[model samples]
Target: MWNLARVAWNLRQSRRLSFAIPPSISATQIDPSFFKRGLPFTTCKGFSTLETQESGGLIPSELLTKKTVLRPDRDIGQYADLVTRVTNFHGEDKGFMVLAGDVFDVPIRKDIIHRVVRWQLAKRQQGTHSTKTISEVSGTGRKPYRQKGTGRARHGTLRGPQFRHGAIMHGPKPRSHAIKLQKKVRRLGLKIALSARTAEGKLIVFEDLALPSHKTKNIVNYVTQMENTKKVLLVDGGPIDDKLKLATRNLHYVNVLPSIGLNVYSILLHDVLVMTQDAVNRIVERMHTPINR
Candidate 1:
């Protein structure tokens, strides 16, 4: 009877202690949203409350339509579409694409371009030609004959302009022969050149040319693959990309020039013309400037 009473007392104490103990649970098993009363944000236009972007942010449509894709109509006599919408890599407005054909081939006077090119060449010849004067020639300073004393004709110093190895008499000398053409003429000439190229189907409009690190060989190879020609001049529409510049510098026949650096001469020098769409836009903007011929 004594042992039974002690056992009952111990069992009762154990039951009381078990009831006071807390339930066992894992921290990972707990629901993270248990602390929230309800959804914190309201719904937006077609997007969830949590997915709403900041106010005044650019729409996805604007971001996608920023760059204007130009589809050149080769069948339409090399005409290209002018796209005036573009965004930079940072999604900022970078301007639009103007078709090369429209800018370069706008009915420009051929004579103006020819005159400008001729004048440019002539200007380069200035100070190049030099003729020796009588005083500068190396020869005898003393008179060869007396002045009209004898029956023979009077003879002067050996270094006279009349004699061989003598100073030239009113001959061609170094002089400035700058040809003056009007500003309108110079502008027209550029337009004519552009027009001629477009008419001849020499102009090319390429998609974006994303360059890698500065590697000329790689660039040259890519260009060669793109256009199966050995002689090519690449015009970058934007700033001079160092990687593209350095890659083509060492190549003998390949010329890579920035769009701003391009002119009629360089464009005509190459057999093939490859311009990025961006470069085409830059060229058109440059034509709008009034140039003095």
Candidate 2:
């Protein structure tokens, strides 16, 4: 069945884009070279649609000429879903899957990702460093020597900062280094990280991570087949499998994480991301889920 609403929306978008053309350059004067520079695409309604290419090419008016009348009422969002293949442990092609556009194909924002990473690292820091103050130091509350009697300079006590092994002044103390960050930013950072990996072709979806034995060689062989994978991140939807964990623990280049444990920092730390199909589903659901805030 054809979607009437989608067709109507597309007509409106096309009309708006056409009206954006420069007034001096009539529709007949539009350059043919513009079509070569852009690709045809269609806008979808939701996050969970398959990526589609349509006949009409949506070229920006700026590409033709910057000087043009603008309308604030036009929606400029161009969303496209990502489609990737799902393979098994043996690298067999299981099938293709459609990932949510909002989760796996969002526009990358490096600043948001950086802020979230800094937040995570700060929260993980153990601010336990401390220094003894003059009052906290153990020493007698007596003058070092008589004032002006000896050639040495007068001192209040042995625990003074001028004396050797004395307490430090204005030194570091134990405290929390964590900073406040919005929950929405953290969530968007995760999505952007995933989208970045996907756009770079470093993300692979596996059917399952379950293995027959805990042999390290099984994982080693599979990992060796990959290209330029200095470090690999394995994500599963549920609890990590025992065999998978044991097999990968010995390999320093490989790391396993549950879907619930996925964060922006961990995703950015590795070179390639290998996730199970279930993991992808869980991530998409989590991205769409609402937050308390």
Candidate 1: 10-residue stretch with minimal lDDT: 55-64
Residues 1-293 of candidate 1: C-alpha lDDT, one tens digit per residue: 99999999999997775554324533344445533534333333443232114322322232222333333444332335434344321234555555655565465455666687887776667576788888789877897878875897777688877678888888778778887767666666666666666655566666555665677667655555544465777777877776767767788887878788776666667776767777876778887766643
TM-score of each: 0.57, 0.73
Evaluated against the true structure, the overall lDDT of model 2 is 0.82
Best by TM-score: 2
TM value for model 1: 0.57
Candidate 2: pairs in clash: none
Each candidate: what lDDT?
A: 0.62, 0.82
Lowest summed lDDT over 10 consecutive residues: which window, candidate 2? 46-55
